[model samples]
Target: MSPLLRYPTVDELATRAAALVTRRPRDARLERVGTSRAGNPLLLLSVGHGSRHALVVAGPHANEPVGGGTVLRLAERALADPALTENADATLNLLLCLDPDGLRRNEGWLHGPYTLGRHFRHFFRPGFLEQPEWLPDGADAVTLPETRALLDLQDELRPLLQCSLHGVDVGGGFVELTHDLPGLPQRVAHTARRLGVPLELGPYDTLYWPSLGPAVYRIPPPRRGDLAAAITEAAVESTWFHPYRHGTVTAVVEAPMWGVRAVQDGSPCADPTAVLRTVSGTLRRDTQLLERISARIRPHVAAAPDAERLLAPVDDYLLVCPGLADTWDPDTDDGPHPLPPLGSAHLAALRISGRRLALRTAGLLHQLVTAAGSDPADALPELDRLLDAWCADYLDGCGARWIPVARQVEYQSRVVLDALALTARRADSLSGEPDWGSQAAVPMHRE
Candidate 1:
């Protein structure tokens, strides 16, 4: 088995990672980021002597294991190479796995071709009170200890080029989020090209405003109080009145991993090692540009007030444009764009439907396991009951306009359940301990 497959458990990962680092002890620093809600410690492996703040965090959602795998592989290789860490003017901080509690819910069976497919399913739940993204009055209500650790580290070592690595399946190929940094587009494009990574621009993708013919989606402006109508209202209002904001960018990049995978997937050579080589090459090509971008932002970093002022509008805009889905366009090479915000009705309907679908799937799986006399079925019925309420709350009265989004939501539901079933089966096989819903419901709390 590959080294990637060999490291399964968290202990195994830590042990193997530490030994790999020992091969070149002088360059990098290995330290704990913080403990998870479930008492698992988050880890960061640093590379580079220069403290010119650069951060790449992965596993924020827990189920998204690809990002974690990519970051860990980079860390391991960087530790081995040493040059990645000992660069003259920049420091690289790697937050390998951010949400350990969420991660452990599907532990032991976290990786592989099969696992990746399952992970893409059931990975998204709306941000709740405990989520890092759920900020109430500018303060997080349920700040997981892991979140606190990340924030504390950010305060202690303010990074200039930070990447909160995440993935989406909206067909936005290799999407990147950009703040209003000078020369950002060119630099991002250049880095992407060097790495053979493709770009799909956002604004044009949604405006249905392609370079060529009529718009792909030419629905007339939605009527007042309509979901689409409200969404358009919000999008236009934010663009005009609200401080024109940019989100997910503090000199950040939101590269869509699967889109890049598509490039390799279609190629004649589909070897994992070669594919990774392509990925590393693409990343390494951008090394100097990243360093330059970091250095260029230094004056802004040094003058903390200036950086804050620059980012303030962006912060304001992001607040107004809730539910900003990432966008991409193949023709323009512009990279990710913020999708028009969904109106409250549409958004609510989508969430409720998703929740119900998830719960129903879980309940059905629980029934299967229990009937087989393999696992306890305590929470299955509760899950089913909750599913009905959630469905009622979100999906009941919405008219036909939401059919498409609802369809997508339903698709997402099927995928999530399928993946969870796979995860459960894998868990059962791994541990002699019988599966039990009584084993604390996968702590999904919505505030």
Candidate 2:
């Protein structure tokens, strides 16, 4: 347990950030961006004196709060050495945590007895449609106050660079960029290696997305009205970084909570079909388990006063996801070449995603059970026991191990610093100036 993993709650983060800003009254200042849907303050720390500005955002998703630590550390580093940013002509603006309401929901396991069981027990992620990172479509009048606040800041600042810090539940780390800048991928890979975090080479979340390198991918801006498509399209389109399209040069660091060597292996399989079967088989098993839990809990949920609100979303997610598993057809060859080997990271991601869905369904069921005033003495505990046992089995099967919080923070921060330095170098080269030899030379982009 690294001291870095002493994950702070929303209140604690606000308090600590305020103190840090107060100490450097002349250089650093804190501002209230807006309030979350739950009314927690969305705060930002402004550091350094320069014409160029960079915005660093974290905690976009409740489950991926590792970025909160990274941003906080960066804020402290910038304040301690004003020369760090002043020389680069870059001002650092840090949004400590974006989704404070969602973050509080995950705080139960933030300060760990950090075990897989405890983490899953306390997990809570909103549906794709409800996530703050995804901007609402025109047809849907839904809008999150947090999203509006961040968008307002981006429009006002039009930052030269924007970095969104994120992390995974398992497997190695990866990077996502808004556009391809020369040598940026190599810098990202080198930073990960130096920090001892393996880069995930397996097909996971980015299976269908375009790749820039082994674990680096580009995030395409959503076309107009694309959010009105399927849930997947809408989810991808909701990325907050996309709206800053005026050459903002966005970067996302997705480190993992735990990693294994299997995640990095990309060797070809003699029987690619068998690999697909294995992956599909895992999803099937997870789906069946969730279906079983849902069946048992449905009766109680239906009897609850707010039954429609509790049951509809959980039922919808389960329906779409389990069917998605059946869509994996290795026998069909639609591509120019043979199917690639199913990487360990892909398998881990599949299993983890399924488990999260099941846990989320169980959580919803628990709420319904409690709300209905029904005696859930047996059903809720059974659901938890089954889910925990399944997670333990999955971990054993995948060979997953714990990663220290300090290491994750270190890797994420280093990547951001390296990227900022690279951007500065690019700006200098374009201006016909020589490299300043330090990250301090990195300048924020001019409008």
Candidate 3:
């Protein structure tokens, strides 16, 4: 068993990971990849002799932590799995917690002897300007020690695969990023299946509306230079999109730990011994398939027009690039307070524009419930209701906004209702019965 998983704490996790690297009997080495704004070391555990390397990072966002645990667990497992540790064809290096200060804020939950409810509540805070992870120094932009560390490490490591383990809401499903890595999606799907998590697909755009898509979208047209079009300018500033700017071509997987408890029945096997069998199996399959596909396409990465186009789907995330919503001012509580309840008009528009995506997302949740060997019909509606209420409270109460945040509430309400209905229908079809005996099973799907 890994020593770190024995006790959970932000400090303990980092210390244990560092200790593991220090004590590694393998030929690999431990190095400092980056430092948090608070000066916490972003350590990298590097193993293998292959030129092809994969970088795994977690804790990019303070609230989302499954990746931190995953990286630690993966490191310990790799130590014993010769196939993972003895790789001569590729190397795997992990960046555990890019934002240690943000991580520090959530230490109570990580090393918790607390109840699950308290742990979850205590750790769930949003990323704001004050967060060490988001605020880099002005002008240079990359001045944030953590960002600099990662940039420097990327230069030094030149990883071919980079997976940042992240989770969405308590209601999220697993998803992977990147157009590269052959059979990458399948591996992600398979891993989620083994873990009893679901995959999110569909209109995630609504989640990033007016910032990324057909909804008043503004992505800073692919280039820089001119404010207006000229008749015959000597130099033309063309707009271009660099997908790599925000994401990596390296294989990236977003693992949702939202339903992790359901998937593995709340298994407390945080240690290498308990989790090694699963991690090794998943990694072996993922690597074998990913390598085969990558080998076939290695020659084309350079020639691919609009290199960013390849990353479109995976790069799309609400948290990556947020909307133009105002941040909550800590100094003054004078902002959009007492958010209006979601309106009917906004709800209608969201339903029309976001139905498909909502359905797809719902399908992912359904998959999670079913994969856990739980009756989807029995579990999904309850999950949907819980998520809806949670979203409502989150959008409305988390912080004061000048603009009514109720639109988000309404959007989520409609989304939750629709999801519940859709999941019920799908579960019925699979089970060949339309019976959900509980009265609570029925959602307020009418609206």
Best model number under lDDT? 2
**Clashing residue pairs for model 2:** 88-440, 134-238, 424-442
**Any runs in candidate 1 off by more than 4 Å, and if so which?**
4-9, 76-84, 113-127, 140-142, 174-178, 181-447
Residue 128, candidate 1: how far off, in angstroms? 3.0
Candidate lDDT scores, in order, read 0.38, 0.70, 0.39
Candidate 3 lDDT over 1-447, as tens digits, reads: 343332234576667676886787465567776566667777777766655455666676675555666666666655655454363354667777777776665665554443323333334332233333232223146456666666656656655445544444332243322222223334334434443343343213223222221111222222222221111111121101112343333322333332212222222323323232332333233334323333333343424432232222112212121111111112223323321222222222222222212222222333334334544135456435543543343334221111111221222222222222333344345569653211144333232
lDDT of 1 by residue, 8-109 (tens): 345555665576568656766778878887688788877767644456666665434445554555565445543334533446677766766655544534
The 10-residue segment of model 2 with minimum total lDDT is: 226-235
- C-alpha root-mean-square deviation, candidate 2: 4.6
Q: Candidate 2: misplaced stretches above 4 Å?
A: 1-3, 136-142, 224-235, 239-241, 302-316, 331-356, 359-377, 429-447
Better of 2 and 3 by TM-score: 2
Report the C-alpha lDDT of model 2 over 208-303, residue by residue, as the tens digit.
667887788877666554322334432255544554565577888788887765667666446555756665566667667667767876765676
The superposed Cα distance between candidate 2 and the true structure at residue 286, in angstroms, equals 2.7
Off by over 4 Å in 3: 1-8, 112-121, 124-140, 203-248, 260-447
Each prediction's TM-score versus the true structure: 0.47, 0.86, 0.48
